[model samples]
Target: PAAPANSGPLTRPQPVSLGMNAPAGPPTWFVCGAAGAGLGPADSYDVVVRIAHPESVYDLDLYGGTTDPDEAAAILAEALVGDLADPHPGSDSRRSTTVLAQLLGPFKAVHGRFPSVPELRQLLDGAAGPLAALRKALTATGHESLLRELDARERQMGHPGDVGAVLADRIALLDRPAFAGFFDTSGQSRPFSLKALDHPVRVRIDLPERGHADASRILARLVLAQFTASVTVRDDRSLFACLLLDDATGVVTPEAVRAVQRLRSANAGVALTLRTLDDVPRPLRGPLLGATGCRMAFSGLTPWDGQDFAEVWGKEWTEARDVTDRQIIAETPAGKAFTVVRRVITGKAPTARAVTVRQVERERWSASELAHGVPAGHAVLSLTTVKGEHAPPLLVDLRGGPRV
Candidate 1:
């Protein structure tokens, strides 16, 4: 018998809380006893991992740049860093000084050293001159102010307040290693190079964890790695380029999403490892998932995350039922059937007989099941296709040697 129905608060079972599954063990890796085989640059991939700890030196060279979502990210490695912020290379007053330094590089190469303003102008006049196209584009873009600023910076390159001089000085300070040079083939540090490719050299850079991390610089380097790989991969499909980023705290910009969309065609890939989905911004959750086609979710995803994944996998027809009445029959003293009532109950209570049961339809794989059911070793693998059909999800074991 059930307790008396009351107007008091109803008692219910405690809600279930998911457990955090510990990793199986340390990662498996073996030392190479034989002579080291270097990875070719053309077949190389650059991976960046960020952790929430002491910052690394590689982060110092970060330069955050952006592009419209409707537009693809573009990078001209041979171009100056100022170009990162503008599609029209020399169109920003803020980067006038930086632009002059670019022209100065070639000017110095042509002559024995730095050229005069007249010499630089003469260089810009050539039919195939880089600055000619830039200036022409500036006029087309209605950036008269930028052109004026460029003229001002060129004339004041040697002045203390000169934009070009200031930019050149800043560049000198910023250019420490190959990390700053996007197109630099001879990346001075092996730790900062790509892993392996069919090219002559590969580079890898591990951020140091000994000091306070620079948020802006770290973000810059991450964008650089992601954008550079994405750009080069498109130009050269024969090369294998990738970025393995760990602790990607702030990589979810429109540019990053666009990069993911564009990378597939370029034969480049960027892999990021984050602590939790909560670490990412809310607006980007769908895009992040959509960009990643093949996904394996471990145990203990939050209810929201589970719901998101559940929705992706979709709903299905499942068996369910409802209760109507309860009826029981018995013979009393070998005569006939009799009914007995032990306790009085509410209107929905079953009669003192057979328990009531009815068939009803319900959806399967409720959000809670995904958020809490599976054990530590097992994971749900859901594959999403471009055509929008989700393959039936599969359960997998992380440490299992192989699936025969």
Candidate 2:
């Protein structure tokens, strides 16, 4: 059946706790790489994963390598199982283990199959017997009812598939309550269903290149998943933030930008940086550039790149002013000399705005002649002092500066 409008966006079953939970804020950064280590060491920032909303925020450290989907799935399963183990020590490890095995099992059994939450739940439910036995063993050791709640959850949720569905549904529900409730005409909303909330301010993705296509797919999926999570819980007043930084070229695919467009439509902010502008594929350039509000140019050396930058900044601005190559003509008593100057001279020459370039020189008497110097901020002064051996510094009073 065609899904209803309120059915919300279709999503792959994501680990409930693989996301972040915080009030939404401006999207400041988006970083993409093979591992979280690429962003920096773990000590750099606080890391948290939302078990209930895997799409929201995740620890990139867990999925670092570029492995096949099956291998990746297996890795994710192991990571999740490991996390659950500490909280439910007495729970049946077999079920959790089996659930992953089935999803990532060998010989095409696990191939082409991305288990939804419901599928995972069913498998886990089947392993309940083993879990129950383990629980009983723990109870005897003085941890009674250690897994009773989990067992009860299994029963209340019914089939393993249903449990998975509920978890997925709840995660989604949390991001889109109104839309989620629209489909439930019974006048009573499901208690644990997903609800829409404000989009998160930041998201981090791990993209490892096991295969070109597969890695691209993973990046694409991460982008879509984040956008889906954002829209389902966006607030009107908030600007969603997406920061994508990739160390590897071609790690982000066209699908990634398309997914970002979805977020942009929801009024989200996005910033994506690659090794170079050329790293952005030609096909995806338009939308990617359109989504960005600002562009920053660092030290670019390539001739083609220099031309590309000129094209991007437009010839009108570059030609309308006499600042090409930052050259300036200074009239000296000896003759007219052309000097290469470092200044940002804007507008047309005679009637244009002029500013002086700040320069730092070593203090001759300082240190064992080992005193070093560095260039600093900008300053503006009269050009008549250009050839003067000694020039007085000009100071403007900010209290009475010209008002625009």
Candidate 3:
């Protein structure tokens, strides 16, 4: 269970204490991995594992409170370029991302903060016309490189606008009246930056999924990108930073997978839940599974989702038994008489039994079993530690029952 929000300064590390308060029940087997040393004389700890409390929690800000404008723009571009419509030209998409970063960086530098949603739309639609003030600020500061980038943006405006149109439509979702008070860089609301993750803080941002799903998805992707980037560059790696996305349907991307791979060294981790493997792009399904340290398949997953889990968990050798029975024929009259007497008492024929046992390879958890054989409130889970140790897939009881 999470401790209450901590506010006071942490002068030293805090060790987690666990009490043995088992309730009365039948004996149950537990799959225990070696605990890290930080667990104290009461436990163990590894350099890769540290415990820290969360200091603050807030919704993700597109332009996080980072001094580097380029980093912020890159994060924003990544979120925009993801989930683009099919038939989107690759070159055009690249140009859009490049121009967006170029314009966003200079604008944030010239002004104090990120542009509002409507201002962002104007910047994308007509950079030269609407951002004249930004251009003047750059020229006055002798930012020749930024001036050239602005020129390039103007030149590209003359080209096909497919990518720009696609991105504009997405931004339009947030520009509505429903989101007027939010996403404003003018300080109408408090801004949160994932870069401050070095401090121990718990944050929960509830998305408005009821009416603004597309906007919510865009914001979710933005939050995910910022988190991956922030955790990578944290100055203090002592605190174990973690991000949990309850329903990460379309937010999984190749960059996110690579970031997950790097979390072990950064002393951070991310937990993402999905309704189905179908939510993940077909090409990334295998890579995502292989990248994560832990994999879970709940009781209600479809056979296809189960098949993916089955493949990753792979097969193990188990013993198979075969039994055969053969009727005995009496060669002698005495034997036949005895057989008849026994048969008369038992009311059945006498037979001899043979047994064969052999080792055979089988799936650890087959697709059928994962899809239908698991009981309600149970799931199959496999875990891997930071030291590269792993535990085979095992059935987990979610409702505090015996785990196998």
- How accurate locally, in lDDT, is each candidate? 0.40, 0.34, 0.65
Give the per-residue lDDT of model 2 (tens digit) for 1-404.
01111111111111111134213432333343444334443332333222223342332222222124344443333323222223343223234333344333321132233333333333344456544554455455554343444355446445633323322322232223222222221223221111122333223344434333333333433333443343534456353444344442443344345555566455443334444556555655555544344432322223333333333333221112233243344578333321222223433222234554544433222221111211112111111111223322222222245421
Candidate 3 lDDT over residue span 224-321, tens digit each = 78878888887877666666565576777766777778887987667666778888877878888988888878778788888999988899999999
Q: In model 3, where do residues sit more than 4 Å from their true spots?
A: 1-60, 85-87, 90-96, 326-352
TM per model?
A: 0.48, 0.34, 0.77
* lDDT (tens digit, per residue) of candidate 1 on 26-101: 1111110001112112123233322221332232122112221111112212122322333433334334434444
Task: Write the candidate numbers in order of decreasing lDDT.
Answer: 3, 1, 2
Q: Against the hidden true structure, what lDDT does model 3 obtain?
A: 0.65
How badly does each model clash, as a count of residue pairs? 29, 34, 13
The positional error of residue 56 in candidate 3, measured at the CA in angstroms, is 14
- What candidate 1 gets wrong by more than 4 Å, as runs, is 1-203, 215-240, 321-325, 328-367, 384-390, 401-404
Runs of candidate 2 exceeding 4 Å displacement: 1-30, 36-38, 41-217, 232-239, 251-255, 258-265, 317-404
